[model samples]
Target: MDDQQNDAAGQAATRHAADRVLDAGALRALAHPLRVRIYDILSQYGPQTASTLAEHLGESSGSTSYHLRALARHALIQECADRGSGRERWWERPVGGVSFTRPAGARTPSERSATQLVMSEFFRHRQDRLLDFVMHSEEAEEDDWSKGAMVSTATARLTPEQLEELSGRIMAIIDETVDRHRDQKGERVRPVSIRADLFPLATLEESS
Candidate 1:
């Protein structure tokens, strides 16, 4: 198959894989720095061979190959059909996106740690991107930028119940907006990421 066809197939496979909510173990598997970097590359550039990734990351092809296998085992990625060469295998992320959902009645320390690790990596990635964008803003056009770019951290006086209610409202707004654009079609309409993060900073007493 041609490269374009291969890329389209790989994207379809990845979107299909992302449709499922990952389990705790799967989240942990995806939390590794190398694995996350691999996903970021695939999301930006489509399917890639382990050798290509190794070259990009300055790591050995064997090491990249191993991490690719681990991601596949966790269902985060899958092997695409190899090009004409039998030795060069390509990999793609399975899902268009990943969401972490905690199971009810969770009590295990290991499970909690897994969740924390995934979240920490996610925030770290976000912070890095924000810093990069700010550092490069001189080269980016201001007219093309959205005014919704701002980061703020503050302590709010709210009970747990109030916080949950606020979170639900925020999620509803996000869902409504997403649903409105779900069927949009145009040359300008491409998949854009919208990340909304809401979490408690600390207990009321601890913050004070």
Candidate 2:
């Protein structure tokens, strides 16, 4: 089965852009790894119940329920109607997804702490995903499987404005491709993540 042809159910998951900027309160609430994991699963897989989420994440229902409530408190997620007559309440990412920024100057200790904690989680999550794939790539023991996973680096010289334009175009293409194939499904298809980073290396003068 072609990789993209599979994962129709995963592709069917609603795509929500991050429209809501997180305030300090929301940032603090999202700083926990478990909370972030919960949010990621819900956002990627669509609506989920605490019990179901707990099962997937290997946590207790009570623990998952607590984190779900905390996320809901900041409106990162909202309650949805139950599936059938089930007692478990389903929750989903808010209509628009969530976002964050470092706090402004004159920050309180709590504000600084929250931002640091949240950013740490962000880096950890990204690195962990790549590391996990690397550790398991050989286990797949297939050319296609190994080739399917990869990392690439490219460098270019350009003015700030030109760089921004280039980045925008590249990102647009990626987004379009992902969206076009978002809902495809096949037995061999599986979920994959695409991450991109573009930044200018610091010049000696700038460093000084």
Model 1: runs farther than 4 Å from truth?
1-19, 82-85, 102-107, 141-193, 199-206
Which model scores highest in lDDT? 2
- Clashes (N, CA, C under 3 Å) per candidate: 2, 7
lDDT: worst 10-residue window of model 2? 8-17
Local distance difference test, each candidate:
0.69, 0.74
Estimated TM-score for each candidate: 0.61, 0.76
Q: How would you encode candidate 2's per-residue C-alpha lDDT over 1-208 as one tens digit per residue?
A: 2444233322323232334767778888987889988887876677888889999999999999999999999888888854524567889885444556654541677877777777777778778888888888788868686787767888899899777556655555565667687667889776677777888999989999
| Candidate 1: 10-residue stretch with minimal lDDT | 8-17
